[model samples]
Target chain A: MSASRHRLGRLIGNAVLLAAVATTLAPLLWMLVTSLRPKQDVFDGALPSALTFDNFSAVLHSVDIGRQLLNSVIFAGGVTLGQLAIGIPAAYAFSQSRGRWSRWAFAVLLLTMSVPFVVVYLPNYILLSEVGLLDSHAGMILPQVASAYGIFLLRQHFQAFPRAIVEAARIDGASEWMVLWRVVVPASRSAISALAIFVFISTWNEYVWPQLVAGAPGMQTLSVGVAAFASEEAGTQWGSIMAAATIACLPTVAAFLALRRQIFNVLLEGAVKG
Target chain B: MAPALLLFGAFVLWPIARTGWLSLHDWNLVSPDREFVGLDNYSELLGDPDFHRLLGRTLMYVAIGLVGGFLLPVGLAMLTLRHAGRATGVYQTLLFVPTVITTAVGALVWQFMYLPSGGPVNELLDTVGISPVNWLKDPSTALPAVGVVGAWQNLGFSYMIALAGLSAVSPTLLEAAELDGASGWQLLRHVVLPLLMPTLLFLATTAVLHALPNVFVAIEILTSGGPAGSSSNLLYDVYSNGLRFFRVGEASAEAVVLMALIGGAAVWQMRLIERGVTYER
Candidate 1:
């Protein structure tokens, strides 16, 4: 009787979690389904009676989504590479340095994570315009390259590296650059990659910053482009709007799925100060 | 190090100082000169009834976020510890999927989901004999509706953190509690919940700090802060005042106030992390 009761408990537990999962995924699934339905048949039901790729084609044809996608790639990729190039060295310096002042400096840097972009974007926007970088890819990518969260997370990972390995590398006459590139970096590949993926995903998803700086028609990232498309056309075009959203979402979603384990492992580290 | 500091200074630190300076003067975007306004902008902002409403609504958004993003995740995380079996990883991965989606796209997807006629949410409501609600258009529901979307996107991240906290609780202690004749609820309430407080507090703090900014994308995409500024918050107001309408001085003052608010939370957050580390040890 106890065994059967325990089984019933497990059965009920599974049911609850499954329901939660369904509720969580239902909206995304509906987005995909609605995007595929015939324009007139969007409200017909949850699942489309027939699949159609015309919405995707229509949105692509109507808007410069292809250019926007490329722009997103360049913008996100540039920001990611720039952050990693700068961040790895800075994180390396922080992890290697020893003293109270260094610790305080690191703390100060981490505190900047809480400084909301809305507060700073106005000045940054003006500064960029003053320098004539506004509405350009460099403008969008440049201001965001130095991320406190990235440096902090990378420092955490770098701190975990074995000190003995570093000592041996130094004794073998390895320069500081070699010590970082040849010794510590190769070992910290997973952390670096995880940070890269995060930076890329975030840069890709960024809305307000890009919207403010990259306002030009040819330079609009996928996020600003899709949002602009939706607000203008939402009154009459559910299918095409969903299609644009799907396009905007695909790259980040794919990156997250492919690197989920690294992401899940890094969550505890990020949450400590995130 | 030099390069990184230069970049950080140019972007983050310098802008903060510039904003503080800008807050003291009146300047439009196109103006060549800024007029010194002293505390006038602050006084004007403080005296405005609309600013008070925006502040209140911003707090409401934070409360909504605490419940939906922080509190609800705690419950869900506890539930996951039971009977999830081998599919635990799969469940977690699927749940976190929403967090990676672009905020703008996520808002657009939700705009469609909350569609008044024949949308999925209303269709679900219709099955229960309830009439379809105009979720976004109606002023009364727009704020909460948008708040719910922010919470939904954030729920996965918070849940993962809570689950990690739950897993860190020693099973031996749980067994000892059971041996001492403590009921399941007693063990949970007395032991598990206390241990989870640091994680929960962290989530709550982030939820509060992030509530206004995170909802910016949704508000811009879905309602543009709405049908009469009904859904507008302080952050949205700041954006409009600064960028859209070019009220530079007033907006900078608002930005200063916002930074102070978030800065206080960040200090609290740092203290919480320190305490949490010592507690864990």
Candidate 2:
């Protein structure tokens, strides 16, 4: 009886977890289904009798989705590059220092994470406008280049680097920059890749900041483009909207699937460290 | 160090300082001169019923989000903790899928799901012989409905945090509990929950702060602060005032109030972190 009860409990547990996972992922699956359904059959009771690739073609061909996708890639790429360029050295300095200034600076960095962007949104807009960068890629990229989370995560990774390796590199006549490049960066690839994936995904999916800064249609990212597409209300083109959304979501989903293990490890590691 | 500091000053600190200055004056986008308000904006905000309603609504959003967001994830983490193996990876990946979707996109998806007709949520209800409910349209269900979506997106991250916490518990203690004839729920309540409090507090605090900014997205996509402004949160109110109506001063005042509320929560979170370290023994 006890064995049977244990088996029953295990079955129930697996069922519940599977249900939760399905509930969580159902919308995304529905998005793919809706995207493929013919436009006329989008809201029909049952699935479309025959799936069509026309919606994908329409989104890719009819709209400026190709340009928007390119714009998203460039914008996300530029910000990721910019963040690594600035964030690494700052993280290195914070990791290496044992002084009051570095300690205080790290604290300030933590404080920035908690500071809401809304507080400074207006000022940022005004500043970007003052510099004549409104409706430009530079306007969107400049503000996001310095992420507090990036600095914090990198500092955590850097602090975990072995001091003996740095000393060995220094004794071999390696400069600080050389040590960082050869020893630290190579050792921390997993963390850096995790952070890069995060930054890329976030920048790709970010809506409000891009919406606020990149106002013109030509400069819009995928998220903003989808929002604009939906808000236009040029009749209820449910299939087309789903197609565009699916296309917009494909990169992140593909990235997650490709790097599922690493992404999971990074998130779990972050949670553990926190 | 110098270059980093210079960039931070130029990018982060200077913008924050400018926001402070802008808050004290009435400046429009087209105006060349700044009109000195001298706390009139804040005082006027105090008299605005809409601001009060938004604050109350924001608190409700936070409360509902905290329960659904943190509790559901914690429960999932606890359930999955004993089964940590290859299958766990699949569960975690599927769960984290929602967090990666754009908030705008997720909102649109949920908006369809909550549709009264032909929506899966209502279809399930109909199978149970219950009447279909208008989720986003009704004032009563609007905020909670949005909160559910927010919770769904956030569940994976919080679950991961709780699982991390659960993993830190000493296996010997769990064995001891089992030997003491502890049932499954008792093992969890007595052995697991206490050890997990620090991580729980951390997750809860972060969850609350994250929920605040999200209210704006919820307002935008789900209800548009609709069904008689029941869902007009502080963030949406600020956006509507400053961006839509160009009431720079009023919006600045609202922003300042929100910062205070969120800043207070941040301070509380820091204190919790410090206390967690001390209490871990």
Best by TM-score: 1
Per-model C-alpha lDDT, please? 0.84, 0.77
Candidate 1: TM-score of chain A is 0.93
Docking class of 1: medium
Scored against the true structure, residue A249 in model 1 reaches a CA lDDT of 83
Worst 10 residues of 1 chain B by lDDT: B173-182
Off by over 4 Å in 2: A269-271, B83-85, B129-132, B171-191, B275-281
Model 1 residue pairs with clashes = none
lDDT of 2 by residue, A1-274 (tens): 6567656666777788999988888887887888889877776754677799888887776679877887798889989888888888889989999999789988877777787776667767778889999899888898888667778878878987889989999999999999998889988887888888878887888887888889588998888898888777442776777888887887888888897766666665544454
lDDT for each residue of candidate 1 in B238-268, tens digit (9 for 90 to 100): 8888988899999999989988888889999
lDDT of 1: 0.84
Evaluate model 1: give its TM-score. 0.94
Model 1: residues >4 Å from true position, as ranges? B171-186, B278-281
